[model samples]
Target chain A: MRAVDTGGYLKGRIRREDIISAAAVVYGEVGYHGASLREIAKRVGMSHAGLLYYFPTKEALLAAVLERRDAEDAEREQLDSPPGLEVLRHYLALASHNVRHPGIVDLYARLAAEAVAPDHPAHEYFKRHYDEARVGVRDSFRVLAESGELRAGVDPEQATITFIALMDGLQVQWLTTPDAVDLVGSLRFYLQALLTVPL
Target chain B: MRAVDTGGYLKGRIRREDIISAAAVVYGEVGYHGASLREIAKRVGMSHAGLLYYFPTKEALLAAVLERRDAEDAEREQLDSPPGLEVLRHYLALASHNVRHPGIVDLYARLAAEAVAPDHPAHEYFKRHYDEARVGVRDSFRVLAESGELRAGVDPEQATITFIALMDGLQVQWLTTPDAVDLVGSLRFYLQALLTVPL
Candidate 1:
């Protein structure tokens, strides 16, 4: 009986993963607001009911997609224990990577803007996202300050906020005019201005 | 006969302005893709054909709405020929004012993100917007630099890009968490860092 239950749970997890991958593709192609669960299920060769069994609702599916993206990003960056300056460098590398994946970038840009509405399905997710992101980056800056590598008179907390703001802002501009805006270059410039030691 | 023709043109302009105002409200409530010309006309107590007579297509109406917004912003700020650092200061004030008008802010955020697509109706508008904005702001920075007010080694062009990026980025954050994100304060911090003299 125990073995049978374990097999069933494993099968369910695999199915869920497949659904998320398909949803990501659909969401990336069109935006969250533009996509429908039916299209995602069709892409995965499942019925809408089958997809609903896994995600319950469109919002649930969206939340799952966002969570998966975050997990993949963290894993890809090996973000476990990078040093203070390394974290910022990782972001630059990520920006370069983002340029190669316009679909994901568009998905993110669209959803982030849509999620600004107070009643949007992803509203709380984005609010918490910015808050958590700011805290994490701030801690990284604090580490640099403690090690005496940060520039003089620069407040770590303020720098963190400005850094994140600049990154988010640049992403929007780059999305619109990929040829005109240099995402990684602009970021590197700002970092050089902020840090005492070169990145 | 010429005076009558001039009066007719004035009347047509007033009707067009009314339609644009109605479209702005509707677009602000829903988004661009979600809004319809019929609905906008309904709001203004006109038939769909009447609105179309003035603006031709939904895209034309959207363009007019955006143009009206830019005009209002310029007029409100008295943005004709402000001095170097004063432009940045004006942005701070604008951010503060933006808090009071969430509808317009959301409209801009949503449309800006959506317009990132090359085929989007407002694509060209946003592209030209960034180009013009950068030149205008860069000129202001140059004026400051010529007077020895800019910080050493700060490039006017780069500062212009970063400044616009920061403002755009802070707007997204502010729209999501108005109480948490200090839009004006963040801009002030960045400006202080860029200028040789304290703001």
Candidate 2:
């Protein structure tokens, strides 16, 4: 009996992970508001009921998709520790990488805008995301400042806000006119201005 | 006969303008996709057919809404001449102004994101908007640079991209957590860093 229970739990966990991967693809292609559970299930070769058994609702699947993207990004960048200016550089590289993944960028752009509504399903998720992201960037700046890597009179908190804002703002432009906007060059220039030593 | 023709033309123009105003409000509230022509007509106390006579389609109404917004913003700021640092200051003030008008901001946020898709109705509008905005900002920076107002080695085009990006990015954060993010203060800080003399 104990062996059977363990096997069942493991199978369910694996199934849930697979469903999340498939859902991410769907969400990226059609956006959160435009995507349907039925389509996501079809992509995974599972019935709608099977998908529900794992996610219960579209919002639940969206949360999982967001978490998976974050995790993958962190792993890809090896962002385990505060890498100071290197993290900013990584962000620029990520922006370039994002150009190749239109669906994912669309997913984020659409959801971020939609999540602005107070009663949106992902509102809390986005609120926490910005708060935590701000703090992380702030701490990175503080590290750079403590080491005298940042320019004189630079405020870590303010730099963090500006850095994050520029990143988010550039994505919209890049999505619209990919060739016109040089996302990495713009960010690199800003960082050079902010840093004591040119990145 | 000429007098009557002139009077009828004036009345038609007035009615068209009235419908555009009502449409802006509706689009701002429910966004482009969520809003309906019937709702906009109801808001203006006009028949649906009458509203259709002016707009022809929802896409046409959306185009007018976007144009009206740009016209109003331009008129409000008097952004006709290159004001250099004053442009940055104006942006900060605009951010504050945007807070009071969440509906208009929401309209912009939603439409801008939706317009990322190739076939979206406002796609061309957004593309032209970013291009024109970047050029205008770049020209302003060039003027400031020539006058030795900008910091040494500051690239006018790069600054243009960063400035615009930060403004757009801050809007997303501000819309979600209005109290937490100081949109104007953040822009002011970035501008101070970019300028040779404090504003």
Candidate 3:
């Protein structure tokens, strides 16, 4: 999904992003325990050994996939302190991306849970990501409060982390109970309320 | 850790509760794929088939274990209407419990993730659980708003779902980054802010 950043990297037939994308699919379809390198290689149209030429190992490949998704949030942080409501707008956009990305969020959430084990490939990835996400959202909300746009005493940092939790958590429900509720719409409604509170 | 209210559950050496506790430890130690009936049976001092006497199947046994944790939650809910700062207090208490009951949460999370496949055993269990959790939280928040305890325009229902999401989403974070931050504290601080209005 990335542009030709490198000068036609090895003819671009086997792109780095392509490998990461395929890895994400396998990670989502199968639990990390159940995911097999052979299956991911097959889906990517590479010999099992050939795929290793690109990823080196399944753990490395898994790490790369996780990093690629993490960059999406990092990009949001670069958008120059948009208004608090605007930040919420972007948050909604990212949530939609999760809905469309098909397995990225699920894989992210699932792997995140596993990262608790000290030996997980994702342990460090989650450690730094959580801090950044928590602080970044908090700062964004704080800017809103300073501008006299917040609902007052909103605890931007706290709200920010909690907001992340809500988003992540609802996505879980959506995965398990697609027929039982509309997760996106529900989240959107909540976001709107939090964004605009009447005294 | 319960006293049977004047006359506890048999006041015996080992009983149903002890069996359930042992099952949880085995389940957590090995996971669903790695854990075995023989292991749990041995931990509880019983034959595999004899263990089946109390629980006819492995699945039934697991469900009972999970239900036992949820039962504790229900008992706590009965003790509090959870007004004022207790909103966050309850949230943190719940998170603490989730941490202590890793096996139950881990199993629930795993099954919830797998339930996306449509044929998982915990499919119906999770589907109903999410439905109830979402609707129940929403209704409770609605009551909060109606009673003028909450600021206007905060749709309690949506916020309720949001609260549930926060729990689910952060549990993943807490599992992954247990040492880096206080997950429950962060959420409570946010909820406390959500409740109070600005000067």
Candidate 4:
């Protein structure tokens, strides 16, 4: 058998990462609809065809970009398997992190909104994304409620929906009027309103 | 002197309203980027040139569509001159109203998110819109705080931002998973958490 080209595979993986990073920036600047694959390729200093070899379609590139974001959040924040209080804290930290990185937040806010249409390329992805997100947060709230850390009379499911919505809504407002909106501060206020223990 | 042509003017006004309504549906379906003037004109059963005579540009039509939505909300909910407690109640009602009218909600969510890009046609429009929205909500919360109706230790400005964000965020979530999300219920939950006075 022919020997595998480990160096070429490694280089290909790195090139894919570069392309995804460039796509995230371009998508933030012009939105997914307004973004051009050619521009993203140009940003990464690759030929359009070369970029397409890595990401065969704009939609595929978008998926990679979004996946990379989720992977980063999971890796950095330990968001994949968080405890109840930690979940709340992580979200607050996330708000702060998003404030520091406006590009991905912009990309997310725009794509989430655009994908609400049933026919959008990312529609199923967003629906599943939100479903999983709600379920995860809801479980944390359930844990908080069971331990009496959550405020009395608060439905964990409803609170989860509200909390997720607040995070998303804050992003749009922050993106729109960053000077006027305080993402982390607002999130903390809501958390304080929800939880019995200090975060 | 030329005749005033009152009947013709009324017909023209009616036609313009029809076009705006149709544009709203199209925008909601495909978003602004995916929608076309020709399609909007076709929906209203008018030639594109005829429609352009009224709106001049796609951007102009988008502005009119957005303005009409705001006008409807203001007139129906009396959101323009809202009292402190009434402001919260009206928003809850607004959420309920939005649930029933998915099309408009879809349009607003998509446009608001897309308009976060500075180069978008609706960018300046949304910036001004959110600024005014925050100011309006903030004033109401201020009035509530002065009357001791707002929860103790709740900052009116912070609450105002959270409240606006909640409304916006709920729309996207609701649009994504209408079967799962309760827009009005979540709004009520937050309002109760914020106010000392019962609705």
Which predicted model would earn the best lDDT?
4
- Better-scoring candidate (TM-score), 1 or 3: 1
Cα-based TM-score, every candidate: 0.90, 0.91, 0.76, 0.85
Ranking by lDDT: 4, 2, 1, 3
iRMSD, all candidates:
1.1, 0.9, 2.4, 0.9
In candidate 1 chain B, what residue range of length 10 has the lowest lDDT sum? B74-83
Interface RMSD of 2: 0.9
Candidate 2: residue A154 lDDT (0-100)? 94
| Chain B TM-scores across candidates | 0.88, 0.86, 0.71, 0.83
| Model 4 alpha-carbon miss at residue B49, Å | 4.6
- How many residue pairs clash (N, CA or C atoms closer than 3 angstroms) in each of the candidate models, in the order given? 0, 0, 3, 0
In model 3, what are the clashing residue pairs, if there are any? Answer: A166-B166, B4-B8, B138-B157
Per residue, candidate 3 scores C-alpha lDDT tens digits across A50-158 of: 7777777666777788887678565863423454566666677777777776467667666666665667666787787777777767777787778766655455666
Q: Weakest 10 consecutive residues, lDDT, candidate 2 chain A?
A: A74-83
lDDT of 3 at A158: 60
Cα lDDT, model 3, residue A51: 77
RMSD of 1: 2.6
Q: What TM-score describes the B chain of model 3?
A: 0.71
lDDT of 4 by residue, B1-199 (tens): 2356887888899999999999888877866777899999999999999999998878778878988888889789888775588877787777788888887777778778877878877888889888888888899999999999988888988998999999999999988898998889888888888777887
lDDT by residue (B60-126, candidate 3, tens digit) is: 6676676676667857754144443344355567777777776667676655665554565556666
DockQ by candidate, in order: 0.71, 0.81, 0.51, 0.77
